[model samples]
Target: MKRTTLSERALVLAPHGRDAPIAASMLAESGIDAQVCTGLPHLIEELDAGAAFVVVTEEAIASADLHPLSDWLEDQEEWSDLPFVLLTSRGGGLERNPAARRHLEVLGNVTFLERPFHPTTLISLARSALRGRCRQYEARARLIALRDSENRFRTLFDTMDEGFCVIEFLDGPHGPASDYVHVQANAAYERHAGIPNVVGQRLRDMVPDEADAWVEMYRRVLMTGEPIRFEQELVATRRHLELAAFRVEPAERREVAVIFQDVTARKRAESELRELNETLERRVQDAVAEREAALAQLHEAQKLETLGQLTGGVAHDINNLLTPITGALDLLSRRHADSDPRSARLFEGALQSAERAKILVSRLLGFARRQALETRAIDVSSTLEGMRDLIASSTGSGIELRLVPSPGLPAAQADPNQLELAVLNLCVNARDAMDGGGVLTIAAEQAVVGPGDAGALRPGAYVRISVVDTGAGMDEATLAKAVEPFFSTKGIGKGTGLGLSMVHGLAAQLGGAFMLSSALGDGTRADLYLPVAQAAADPAPVGGNDAIRPVKPLTLLLVDDEDLVRAGTAEMLRDLGHVVHEASGGAQALAKLGPDHKFDAVVTDYMMPQMNGVELAGRIAARDPGLPLLVVTGYAGGNLDVGLPQLAKPFRQADIAAAIERLVHGEKVVRLRPRRDANSAA
Candidate 1:
């Protein structure tokens, strides 16, 4: 319900001239909505301004050139039948013309009366016309209001510079693809296409590929009976178009309406984004590959560094043993009489030195290869259980051996033999530390070390086998070199000190952490943190198989570029009771064994001029088909042992005896195991 306010009311008046005053008098009396006009033209202008009705004298129509007024009256719209009245003379015997009656009828909504009519009659007719005119005035007011609103909307939409378009379905085919025609478009669309009229044309004709896409989209929408909206790029014109289209079906119309905007700049930005993504992906791949390669190289360097350390330590320990081993055996043989029963003491001393040499050689072989290993991953509890007898023996009968294994202990990857040796070394050291006798306690538990536990150690669980002793520990100076080869706290000649160094080397090789703690008065604690190895793989043994093969002996022609070695070896051969010849050089040896001498064996030293051991052996083997020749040298030439036995130089007389005895018996020389230290950890 709309309420009409005072300002919206229409006013009425008689045509300008004689009745204008009377109409004013009627308005003054009535106090209703009203205004006055001079003529039909003035009436139209007043109506245009805001007049609603008009009144006039009938004689003015007779005297007036009424075509202008008639043309104006004819122009009045059907709904706005402007209320009009005519005052005429009815008493002068004037007759109305039929044509004029028809003409007056053409001028719609007209009233007439005689000139002498009462004021009440004029007022009654005026009031009725006023009422009808007010109804027309309401209709006219709404039509004008609509026109104003349309103008406002058009002004706003047209002024915006961004391109916008609206599409609607038409009743018939519209293009080559028969795309639905557009019903409306804003000024931007017209500007883009450089066309004045855009509406009623198919979308494809206006935009590229718009026909094929839009018709298919509309077909889907018609079936789905749902509104679909999206942003898409059409590729036909090689231009980026950011478009949003939606299906719209009206209640009374079958056409689906689509509204969209053009966003080419947005599409270009998205393309650039994809290219940037490709570049980032490539960079990430390169970074990952570079990181992997760096890690690989770092690991290789670490392995080589560890190998160098172990080799140097082993060499140093062996060098220290060489003097005692070779010198002792030589002295004992020269000094001890065969008839003297007590002379066996000197022989026994020499035997111990020789055994030490053998042990040193075994460690070197182990460093080279590990093939047949007695490996079993056992927890500290199991390890302690097996060590009771050995520990008691190492610590002495007076001192106690305490095995304290933590609950839920993890298993350590170790060879029972190797691990036992290490433990024994520690025990022996402890027993030596506690000369007055003290307790040796072994603590075992699962250990987890992250960066928080050790400096830059990768986080993982391990078996921390800590051997703690209640004996008097070493001073700071002595403790620092506890694991250095041949470094001993004991007085001179009491300890060889290869024990702890071996433990350290073994732990490092197993990828484990070895941490030692000790104070002047406090007992030592050596914690061996072995990484969690696979449960069954223990420390494997190396050189388990004798790589040397057996062969027949040949007529002997032997050489040694060194005097001591050559004379000693010849003496050893005489001891073995074999017929032999000796030469100071390779050339002399080859001259002794002629091409047709039918030699049974040939022995030659490798590092010699005038035909080295390799050339001598090759010439001999070429002459004899089933002969065994042994090449002895500190260093071998390439291909020196291709078809014959090869031996290292600086050997004992017994080693030479063993090599020949084995070769004569067609038995290969097997590498012996290192005699492990039994009194390790106490």
Candidate 2:
């Protein structure tokens, strides 16, 4: 919609040539562009291009047929009104002439000047006509802008997805303006509301029952000019409508514009969802109650489990105490009935039962006191290598055993016998963890320890002995208590739970620390830290039972807190052809030793009511520096820290004889000195 401007060209339709030139000159001087035309045909050409005004003579208008000009003027649009300035003679009968009057009527906006008119009068009339033409062009531009705005609005209104309608309030004879007519509607209004041909119709005529409420809503909007939004059901179509109504053209008539949508399905779904939520809440409460009952039952089951563990530990301790009794009885039975050798097999079976029972008892006391340790310097690498066969047999065929000792592993200051037992215990635990077959690795490496490195062990050098198992590992809770006495994760009777505990006790007693680490599925690793020995490891004979040289029988002192064990040991010493002096404890033994008595050796129990064996031996050695001393202990309990020969309880007669003979004959008498440092042996 583009507007056309007033043309600069003013067509002069005068018939005389001189008059046309003069008129052109006058227009040019007046700053108006003019074109002189000879005839009506030429005038038509100029008018076709565009024109501001037309000047014509009375004769030209009277003689000529102005139908072409008439047709051009009649074809003009509403915004166009081309002005014409007619030049007439004085007393000209142009207005009376029928043809001129006809032409004047066709040319709608025209000005006339009589003959002998002043030049200024003609110029002023011509300029006034041009000014009116310019105003017409301005009107045309406004019309075009209005048309474009209407077209854009119409496109937007028709393309909207929501229903839209413009309603004009219609007043009745009395009362309020209660009726509203749909003056305009978009395409979506009929589709969404399910009502067609609703425009140009009164609300009361279309839906008599629903009309009043809707008319009231429209009246409120028109009166107050306030926008409102509400959801309501239309009874005529059974549709739920979400509508927003706002007053439009506030300065003009009362008209309301409505934008609405169909939401019946959404409303139905909301009702169903509310019912479902209520049902779920009840079910959740029921589930919570059931869970509480289950938790109570679980707590009762845990109580029974704890009782079973206590029973197992008690049974194990009883078995340990009975082991020595069973062995002694078996030996006595063999000695009495050796003539009838058939009775020996029955005694042997009894011994086997006792051995089995002992193993069960020992498992329950896994972290209990271990036997006395004879601490010495030993190569950790060689120690592990030597125990390969024993470890393999104990772990069974299901486990693959590997003894991987790192090159240049230093000798560790610990008892070789105790270290071997600790490694075996770890391997056995690893075997049980792997229900299926897996690899058990025993490795040794040299480690340097600075201050605050290994717990409770003085900073220096160390030998790290690691036992790793490719088996089911432990969780954090289980690993935290792995080294606690009798805290087994295995089922009752499956394990004594003393494996890690005993290893931990052994390392600590040997002036080192024990560390265990595991993850749920990543298997377990146990590390035994033993301080590095200052001297090279002694490679001693494996066994020297047959190599003992018989020594002459000598007087010996025997000491024990237990009356029965002391009597039995004294009787054994007398049977071996040695004179024996018996004392109840370290106090009595020290009293018996005086300047008048001569004794070849002193044998005493490590744990007594007062002045135990290690203390007694130290005192005896102080009194008689050359006197040989030996310690016998049932359970050392980490108190055997004296550099003296030790004999573990439940030893055979041959074992006692060998120890006494070695000390009496000057074979291997332990050096007694003002001790450099107390022994770290247990």
Candidate 3:
């Protein structure tokens, strides 16, 4: 590798006539690059710019009163010797002149050279002078660097954000106990300690109590030879400070240096923050109270709106049933076949009409109160397929409806009839949105929202079905209160506005979120979510049981307060070939079933004042271990609490048969009828 090292110049500043080049040549031969400066004025700039040496001639140096260069040379380190070469024609005579000798005597290191000398003698004097100058350069560079470094250290200490201070040992009885005297302190440190003119003072004299604390701290540090840090608050000033101290080597002895920073403002800010938090907590409590009151008002409004929707659903379904009946009756009346006397066929038609009327009555009761839910694992897609014709007919010819039902949708646990009603409400809402003529898109898709979602949805997969309308859309403000009870969009007689609120409440009870998105001129979309049912066991296929032998008939108790319903129901039971016992109400029925009579099944209505179906079922279940009790009613409220089976009213005769068979067999049914769950499976 190529040799590389930095070579320094040795400059010997002297007058032009003194043969500086000749002197430099001698030093060059001695392996020192020496140059004599032309003037004293340029010495500072040259030396600062990294020049090495300085030399002066005797005639110029002795007569030169301005000793700027000499003073600068004296400030150098002790190892430095700034050499000066003197040229003398009469050497001994020069020494004899008292004034000249006095000046020369003071300049001790300079060599005297007699003129008319040999090159060897002249070269030796110049080389010796240059050698001394080299020593001066080394000393000056090191000391000056150290002096400049002190200013750097002071600048950093003063400019730091944290207050800093240095304390030195002092000479006194109190000082012996104290850590050190306060020798240096930054501006912030002085203000915090409340000590003025802090430098070069005894710590104990300035701050007596603080001095005692420092004594205990310093003693530990000296004994352990380790640094210590502590945070404390001043009792008098209530100022918080962080104190740090360590052992350091002083010029002549070992001393401990301590630095303390004030943290009072930070502590005060934290206190204020805690106070703000308390204020915020009070505000939150007030808000919660207001929210509870609002919810109470909303619940009252919902009760009234629910009554309105029941009336509307009743009116709508009755109107639909009338179309077929009225048509058949009109045809019969137009024929005028009196002699034929169509009694049997007319009685059958009357039965169908009575069945329709019964359905309307049960639906009315369902709306007046809550209804008993007949839950089952239903194929919602299939049910939707059944309603395809009804939905199309329900909407006007002007509205274009696109029913995009998912073909392979998962099975949802729901009451098929109730779910049908809820879906009909959605379709009605969509039709109302498209007043003129527009496409209403109802699409179903599977979705998953996990934790960290903005809505904070539960971690599970859900079926999301959206009813999208290309019609007059709602604004953001309207969308926010869209699901509020009794919040109507249509004018006075046109709507009760319970459509969305009911949808929301029902969905919430089913453990799901009800979401609505709409923008002016864009569209309105409602997203319905429902939790998925985990298939804990394989799905059991419930096949038609025509091949299996029927179980032996046992006594069946049929109970109802309504005379027409009991009589009509008894006729239907006798037609099915069963031993039946009829009772007017729950109390009369219980007296008949008392000990002597053991019934295979008990079918009763839920909303009886004397003895409710639930209460009767509970009494019976408490009394008998294995008797199967089937609760038949239109009013089932909340969740089911017992093992008794439930069946909603307004059913086909076939519906009664299927339910009784299932209860007798003790088949597992879905909990409460989940209309919203249908949306999930779809």
Error of 1 at 282 (Å): 5.9
The residue-by-residue lDDT of candidate 1 on 1-682, one tens digit each, is 1222213223333444557677557655755555655665665565555444566666555555666666666766533566566666652122653334643654555666456654544565666666656555555455555456556546745664544455655544453325566676777764433455877776656664465675777656655666555555545444444333433434234455343445455555655544543443344345445545544544444334334334432332343234235534554454453565566666656655655554444454444342223346755577677788978976888788888888766667765556767778888888888878888888888877766674434688778788888778778878887886666767754776677887887777666767788998888898887776666444333321123232333346668765655666666555445566888875677677665555556666665545666566555555554566676654321123344565554455555555665655656532212224322211
Task: Quote each prediction's TM-score.
Answer: 0.34, 0.37, 0.41
**How well is each residue in 566-645 modelled by candidate 2, as lDDT tens digits?**
77777667756789999997778989999878998898877665466766766777788888888876543223456677
Please tell me which model should have the higher TM-score, number 1 or number 3. Answer: 3
List where candidate 1 sits over 4 angstroms from the true fold. Answer: 1-285, 288-292, 295-299, 302-343, 370-556, 577-580, 595-600, 605-615, 631-655, 665-682
Tens-digit lDDT string for candidate 3 (1-682): 1211122555555575656777777668767677567766665445544543344455555566546655655554443444545555555244454444644545545455555443545444554444445544544454455446555556756775555665555445544434466666778776775556777776566666666776677766755668777777665456777666665543344466566656666655544544543443344344445545544644554345335434532332333333334334433432343444575357446645645564445444443434444445666556666777888888778877787767666655544555566667777887887778788777766678878676735877766667788878899878888898678788854677767776776566556667888888887888777555454222333421122234446578988765655665665455456688998887798799887887888877554545666666655655665667777654333224544576645444455666777877757532223233222211
**lDDT per prediction?**
0.57, 0.71, 0.58
Error of 1 at 6 (Å): 99
- Number of the top candidate by TM-score? 3
lDDT of 3 at 52: 34
As a whole number from 0 to 100, the lDDT of residue 130 in candidate 1 is 64
Q: Using lDDT as the measure, what is the rank order of every candidate, best first?
A: 2, 3, 1
